[model samples]
Target: MTILTASAPRDEMSGAPDVRVVAVPAGHPYVQRVTDAAGIALLPDPPVPGAAEGVWWPPVALDPDWIRANGDRADVLHVHFGTESFAAGHLTACVEAAHAAGWVVVFTVHDLTHPQLVDQRPYAAQLDELVPCADALITLTTGAAAEVRERWGREAVVLPHPAILREGASPTVVALSEDLRVGMHLKDLRPGTDGPESARTLVAAVERLREQGRHAVAEIRMHRSVRDEIARDEVRAAVAGHPYAVLVEQGRLPDAALNAALGGLDVCVLPYRYGSHSGWLELCWDLGVPVAAPDVGHFSDQHDDASTASFHPGDVDTLTEALHALLSRHEAARPGSIARAEIIEARRAHRREQDAATATAHAALYRRLRSERAS
Candidate 1:
């Protein structure tokens, strides 16, 4: 690889108005929301033909050779996702190349554990290579920052995630619904998931609710993918065994439709088997929808809101109980409930404050890193 022999871009500022970042996948919603007007200009990812996600995939910037060849294009290398794309040795080479090329490397520890893999060791190896070498570390929660410090011996900044749906967004985005629709979206199962198990648990919850003569339904939504064929079939079989369980789709919905599907639900279950943080939880919060997430990683620490409930991962009873509790709370505030409006508005207000803070923190860090290099 042709390494840049300079030692001083180390971050991205020389009194410039904005810091240019070569984010691994700049097109992701989280990245876009946080960096928007943050004085951080994210260089676009390399174009890919016919990409399904409407963004880049397997980000080209993660490649060691890419760093070596075009490291000067940006002031910082901020990697938020796509660590599963490289091996330990390869990731190490990329980091080393960044230093040699004078680019500051900022790694956000989005996941201490990879959600797509059953084996943790390989991902561990990759983390071992990157974490120690990162100039700055960031995670979404203090709980996760503590874990990062304990595991990688690094201090990571705790930045709350920005709002996906900004404040004052049209309330008509989600059509109103009365039924207690408990959603378990198993799209491609996310590879490492408890969604099938959650579906069974949800089915049980609905059955009990029906027995009590409640307008409740376990809504199972899924679409097949090569990585989750087994998981999809398993969920389908489970749903088939239950006459009351409803399967929403076998094909993926567009963004508007997906958001509507989630908004239409009274409760959405997060069925992660393992991992850290979640964009889905944040999205649900933005939609003013209640969520019942498994107690794994720092999900419990992400937000202090009554709308979110936590259950023991893999425990059907706990998940079911969480569903009951969340639903009870949701129903208590309905039919032009002001309490519901306050919660939604409060969340949006908090996100407004958090967004400003998040932007300022990132901008300050980038400036500091850049100054250190220039000095």
Candidate 2:
């Protein structure tokens, strides 16, 4: 059945098909792939910067003219992280415009904000307002979907984030070099007053690993967009005594460079104080790297039942122990690594299945909307 998809206009995809998709001003890692897989044509939006930086605001305003022009062509409007961008008034107007144009609106809620910021009055209210407008909602994880349903009385479809599968790898054993190298990606060292407090703890844990001589070399790649001089100073101060701790400011590396960096690391560690979910963890799982994270919130859910390790967020001892165990297991070629690799592969497979299902489900939704309008 043919369906309409409205999104920002872009030429990345070739000929137009039955589905009409309005490509938003910004694109995420999986945006283009999902659109292509679903056979949707792109409707280009104005140039918007910081699309991937977690700052959801689109540079181009979603005005009546743009919506009228594009909305009329599509049966459905698919948007990502709507709560982050649309204010109550603007969101209400946009929803009304889509409805007026006889279109169904689908929104994907990535984060309600790390648990710490749940109390932020404005963000919470905005989300509450936006939830009810969506004909359907999509979340990255079941845990997140459940939270949205419970909090806002909105049923959301749970689809795991798309996995990053490396070519020519079958979840095989990746030999750990004599030099143990650890990699971490931290968007911000200081998460506002409401942000997670795990940064200090993470730094200390790394210091402990250095002391034990387990992690002789480690690179903590902090994204430049989120890192400030003040945060850098704080990081330096926290790991002052540890000579092995190296802080690399990776402003923004292209996809290939980012993958290359991740491929070289022996292990990937995420020490989150508190959060809803992590796409980074999904990236680690896809890459077949043994992941070490603190026992907090939805993190445990990401770990394969058979192949995952956890540590207390602020407990240096637990963190140290977890690192030691992972390092030792890698050095000895223990079956744990192999098992974990299998879990990673399984997770990736699961994501592919889920993405396909989500696409079909959304397509069905669009078809239903078109039928209703015709009747």
User: Considering every candidate listed, which one attains the maximal TM-score?
Assistant: 1
Tens-digit lDDT track for model 1 on 278-336?
88888888776788888888888877867788988767677777878888877854423
Stretches of candidate 2 off by over 4 Å are 1-16, 23-26, 48-61, 114-119, 165-175, 187-200, 206-217, 223-227, 271-274, 294-297, 303-308, 321-354
lDDT of each: 0.76, 0.60
Candidate 1 yields a Cα-based lDDT of 0.76
Residue-level error in angstroms, candidate 1, position 118: 2.9
Q: What's each prediction's TM-score?
A: 0.87, 0.75
Instruction: List model 2 lDDT by residue over 171-212, tens digit each.
Output: 334465556776666655535221123445556666787777
